[model samples]
Target: MADSPLPDKLDNARVLIYSHDTFGLGHLRRCRTLAHALVEQYKGLSVLILTGSPIIGRFDFKARVDFVRIPGVIKLHNGEYTSLGLHIDLQHTLKLRESIILHTAEAFEPDLFLVDKEPLGLKGEVESTLKLLKQKGVATVLGIRDVLDAPHLLRPEWESKGAGAALQEYYNEVWVYGDRSMGNPLEGLGLPAQIEQMTHYTGYLQREVPESVPSKHLLGVPQNYLLITPGGGGDGVEMVDWALRAYELDSSSLPHGLFVLGPFMALAEQQAFRERISRIENASLVTFDNRMESLIDNAAAVVAMGGYNTFCEILSFNKPALLIPRTRPREEQLIRAEKASDLGLVSLLDPRKGIDATEMHRALQALLKQSPPRELVADCFLNGLDKVCQRALALMPRS
Candidate 1:
């Protein structure tokens, strides 16, 4: 048997990313984007992601990067969790996930460790690994989205989950993937001074336009179309339905509409959407698009749920967008959308405020017909990956 390469013998910088993605594609996608950006900026870097997203394998990874899929845990809409497609008990599944995470960190011995979103991870699953990393003197950073939630909810949740303590004791830094002038992800909860000082606003991770994408003509779409995307589509039925309803009123509101119904949308709901899509002469629907950035680049405008990743894309492309943000479970999206609107970056349509097809159509018409004054948001933050790569390089040991 061959001996494993010793730590000093390894020539590449290793970064281990933990994305406890209980649901949706947001966290995994962000981590993967950061990973790719890091590899690009810092040559001879190897990346490994520990992810629990069920669809982790569906997306392709770049060279010198891969993932170990942790046992899946599903978080229901009502804030409950269960083993995703696993016959084992939830506790066992979590234990198995924890074991794999800790084992991977130990074996990988990465130069830096990045934890996405949750500070202690889902139900504190990554606590042991965090502790071990701390003892090993591994540089640790917790990467948080632009919006966490309403401060009241975040305070209680962090307190009960010991997230604040974990942040202070284990991690060396916390990077918010947003600009501070936009909104603080930690605004509501009064974090201790030390921990607060540790947080750095890295700005938004701007997605790069793909080198090549199918042309609008080749994709069988008109020259101009409003791109309607509900992100992962798990909680996107309302947005998709509303867009279709808007089209029913006036197809001219948007000359053409291309809807990317995420794969997580329920089959029955998608079928219902397909029925509606059939009725709208100028609207198109695709169940999924692995490279959504390409579609974003080609689209004339955007209408979306205003998730963090989607907002980043809209900012990157400077797309005139109508954001219909959900205000349930967490008000992160709602708050972000409102803030972005105030900054003249995007417009918002709060779904809960008695909005209907007419309202959606009005928003759509405004977005598609009128290009937003891009100059207002000309200074918006979009170079997060660059800043993050710099910080990581500074923090990395002399490997």
Candidate 2:
């Protein structure tokens, strides 16, 4: 392999991160953490993130890190998508996204391109942009979470779409943001052993919460309140609804429940939920919160859908949690929840099998009354941002 042409001077290095946060917050949030870590570790290095999150401005970012927001699009159940607004069509949105990506790369001329999760880039939108970057002799990498999905489900999809081939040809390195001992995301991709050599496990990257930050919700609520969250609220309506129903049917004196309907939750759905749950004295609904770690840390227990970022937050906070993962499209959450449960870190419930009010109440009771198993608190937890930043910096071009 040839060495990269990027300048050796750290002050001249520019890094660009691409995160397609089309439907959820996990991808974007992960990229932000990485960008911050990279900038902090490599002095004088500047970072830019290209994201499709409509609410990108809502979050706080460290200095020298910035983002360019792409037009929003939402995927429907039938595998089709539409622009998020009345003015933009799907084609226009794609074009706009492509233009912004290309323009950013051209202007910034980043020495490294770290792409999050999406290999083909936003339904294949970034292919041309990547080609352009490669032509400019820029180094590119793909950063994936521990589990994209079950191997069986992910294999055929990648094979049919030539995703594996794209990664092999375009990406200089593939960083799995998880330990392989937990699970190998690339096991069934049919790639050769040489491809495995290009892979590096960076362990899990978690946001560090300051110990002194106090939680507002923890102020008056008794020690029994359980925090319920659906990440981004795009596909989390069912889980939130189930939890609310459980609170309504409580025969025992129920703990106060705080539900955070993420920012992306539909207006109609939010209004409906508010109407239904407003009458319940124990339930409080709020929009998406950036300071979720504080809330999670102070909570007595947690009920959530099993997204990777949310799962990590639950683990880091060391709170007893009940995970109700989604079943269809992909079983990423289900796989993570089951593994964590096997490790005795948390409880898992299947919504399809009928998780009613009684079950929710019982699960909450058990979790609050008992501590998470000892095995759950083992060395599986990682704080790996520094190590990942080191590796990324090493991969940058030397003068």
Candidate 3:
């Protein structure tokens, strides 16, 4: 790829983001956050995100920040890919996604093309789009979260996917959305120096309190309650179960628990969770909330599985949190939880060891005693959004 010269001036630049939202809400949420931040920073800039999230319509979007919903696909628990709500083969669904992605790129003609998580998209679905954009000299960036997974797991996964070669061949820049002090997503990948030179650590994206909030009636709970969220709740059943067990074990004078079980949780699991929580007087369950930042901000404290988005919110809102990270499928959350615990940002509770009601009860009590994240970290730790805007400007055509 040839170096694209920096332009002389800025104008109504356009940006396109691709989010291969196969499993959880993380990819789509991250892309949406960036899209909102970018358009807010640049007056005339518009960001159009291409996502495969079935619930994309559920989330609210600001003006000049919109999404194009491609054919939705989902990842099954057994690590198989299948179309979401469509009775078709996975290959056909992938082909449809790829065509829509390329078509959107051609029509949008964005000045900057940003991709979230998957370097080459799900099964290299975005490979052709990236190549076409590179040929057109559209600046391409790969945005990744703080921790992908354990090195052992990530290495084989990337090797099989040819992520390193794609990074070197297609991307103009790689943005790690995390502080290097916390963790590096690309730590042991052993990519070439060219990829390293083009990479930037943009820190974690900061979340803000939403302008609109759900009323107490809508939330089915009052303020100043303890928030328990298993982000996206697909793999969060354990966390939720543990929390409920804790409450059941000791219905002491602890804070009221409000659980946001996430949207992707299985129907049977959700029903079971509801039944369990119904018996617990101090706990209330909400299956999902699109505007979760509000709940996080308003909480007295938080108990959650340490997903990337939740980590950002915990810091952004400076809440005292206890993270019970999952260790299977991927150790990304576990790695992040360990790092945050080391940094004194949050407390860690590994479910691998044991999540008995007694242990969970102790953790809940400990959460309130822990200091808020901002008190421990520097004030500038939440400057990821500002830095990302600056980096976007540098990569974008100013003319």
Q: What C-alpha lDDT values do all the predictions have?
A: 0.84, 0.79, 0.87
Candidate 2 Cα deviation (angstroms), residue 330: 1.5
After superposition, the stretches of candidate 3 with alpha carbons farther than 4 Å from their true spots are 1-10, 212-220
Say which prediction, candidate 2 or candidate 3, comes out ahead on TM-score.
3
Q: Write the per-residue lDDT of candidate 1 for residues 1-399, one digit (tens) a residue.
A: 012122222257899999988777898899999998877666688999999898988887888889999989889978989999889999999999999999999999999999998988888899999989889899999999989899987899888888888888898899999998787788768688888889888888989765575734327888667899999989988888888888988886467889899988999999988888888789888988778888887788899999999889987877888888878898888999999888878888888876788888888878876565346653537768877877887778874
Worst 10 residues of 3 by lDDT: 1-10
Model 1 TM-score? 0.95
Ranking by lDDT: 3, 1, 2
Q: Can you give the lDDT of residue 207 in candidate 2? A: 57
Candidate 2 — which residues are off by over 4 angstroms?
Answer: 1-9, 215-220, 373-380
Please provide TM-scores, in order, for all candidate models, with all chains considered together.
0.95, 0.91, 0.95
TM-score, predicted candidate 3 vs. hidden true structure? 0.95
Candidate 2 overall lDDT versus native:
0.79
Q: How well is each residue in 78-131 modelled by candidate 2, as lDDT tens digits? A: 768888764867888898888888888899999899998878787788888799
Model 2 worst lDDT run, 10 consecutive residues = 1-10
Better of 1 and 2 by lDDT: 1
Query: Judged by TM-score relative to the true structure, which candidate is superior, 1 or 2?
Result: 1
